[model samples]
Each structure stands twice: as structure tokens, then as C-alpha cells.
Target: MNTISVQEADFDVGAEIEALSAGRCDVGAVASFVGLVRADTLAGGGDEVSAMTLEHYPGMTEKSLEAIVAEADGRWRLLGTRVIHRFGRLVPGERIVFVGVASSHRGDAFAACEFIMDYLKTRAPFWKKEDTPAGGRWVDAREADDSAAARWAK
Candidate 1:
């Protein structure tokens, strides 16, 4: 099972992970990643981020996330995966995204979880605008994110 969601409301990680592998004895390991709005200056947080607004095209965002998860399923031996991304005005330290993967082994779970998040950071069609002391500014694609996603190229 693979679940992909894009919304403004926050999610419960424990619930999401549990649902991914619920009643599955074959799942030996479950790895998850939660992305948060950081205070990093490069992310437009300047000294402090009063708020961050994330936006995405209605239907396109969900489809893009689905494709990223499908790619991870093809690359790794995964039992299930969950991807939840939030869009709206968020404060620093607020959860922004979550990627959870379940598998028979820790390696597959970890790798698939990371691969899904890497692709999500680079390929997802979501845009961000941060509100800082310097005012609002749109975030740019970081080379590091691109490089991370590139390493898994088939």
C-alpha cells in the first residue's frame, strides 16, 4: 500500500506510520522522515521566520507525489509507503512533510524512506514563500537537494 496526501492540515506521524503497516507481520522495519520548517537563513528564515507559506497546484501536487512514491517502490523492496505534505502558513519548527516506508529489513526501509523524501524535495511541484524580518521571499531550489535526488537516477 502507498498513500500520498497534500493538504494544509497537519498530520499525526504515529497514526500515519501505524496505518501504513497496520496488521502486517511481514513488516520488520518501518522508517520515517519528518521535514520541518527550519530557522536556516538560506531557507528565508533570516534571523527568525514569522511564518512560511507553501503552495501547490491542486491536482498536480498529489500526482507528482504519487509518482515519486512509485519510483521508490520500484527501486526498493518496500511493503508500504506514506507521504504527507502540508501547505499553508506555518511557523518555524512546524512539520512540513512526512515520508514513511515499511519493509522486511531496515536497509530497505531506510533507503526507500530517504529516496522518497529526496525525490519529494526536488521533484514535487510545491512552492514556498517565507516571511522573515526581511519580508517575504520565494524559496529557490537548492543544489544540494538536486544532487541528492540525482544520485538515485536510473
Candidate 2:
């Protein structure tokens, strides 16, 4: 089973992973990633990020996420995958995103999880704004993220 969700409520990683591979005896490995809002960063003058708000086009965002997972599935032998992203106001240390992959081997599960996250970082149509002492500033796309996504190019 594949699960994709864009929500404002926080999620339980363990529950999602369990749901993804539930009753699937063939699954041997499950890889998961949980992204959290960082309070401190070197992005702008090493300011402390107090809070963040994320926005996205509802239908468009889910489609982009599904496409990313589809790409990963095509590249790896995945038994199941789950992606959950949160929007709206969030404070530092709050969970932001979750990616889970289940496969018969660790290699495929690991690679597919990373691939989905890398692509989501660059390809997903989500906009973020961080609140700092200086004020709220829109987050810019990181070239490093682009570079990471580019590695999967054929």
C-alpha cells in the first residue's frame, strides 16, 4: 500500500510505518525519515528560527509528492511507501515531514527512502517562511538540494 497525505496535524512515524508494511510478510526492511523544524541554522546571519509556516497548493502538492514516490518506486523494488507532510504554523522542533519505504532488502529500502526525500526537497511545490529575530523571511531553494536531486537523473 502507498500512502500520501498533506495535513496540518502532526503524525506518528511508528504508526505510519506499521501501516505501510502491515500484514506484508515479504517485507524485510523498512526505512523511514522524519524531518523537523530546526531552531538554529546558518542560513541568514546564523539567526535562530523561532517558528515556521508552510504553504502549498492543495491538489498540486499531493500530486507532486505522489510523483516523487512513483519515481522512487520505478527505480527500486519497493513493497510500500508512505509520505506525510504538514503545513501551517509550526514551532522549532516540530515534525514537518515523514518518508517511509518498505522493501525486501535494506539496500532498496534505504536508497528509495533517500531518493524520495531528495526529490521532495527540490520538486515538491511547497513554500516555507521562517520567523527569526529579524522577522519572517521566505525560505529560498538550496542549491545543495538541487544537487542532491540531480544525482538521480538518468
On TM-score, the candidate that comes out on top is 2
Candidate 2 — what's its lDDT?
0.92
Write down the TM-score of every candidate: 0.93, 0.95
> Using alpha carbons, what is the TM-score of model 2?
0.95
31-142 per-residue lDDT for model 1 (tens digits): 9999999765654333576789998888989998988888888888999998899999999889999999999999999999988888888888999998878789888889
Clashes of 2: 0
lDDT of 1 at 55: 89
- Residue 53 deviation, candidate 1, in Å? 0.2
Candidate 2, 1-154: lDDT as tens digits: 7889999999988899898778879999999999999887764566888999999988989999999988888999999999999999999989999999999999999999999999999988899999988899899899999999999899
Q: Ten residues in a row with the worst lDDT in model 1? A: 40-49
Sequence-dependent TM-score of model 1: 0.93
Measured with C-alpha atoms, the lDDT of residue 94 in candidate 1 is: 94
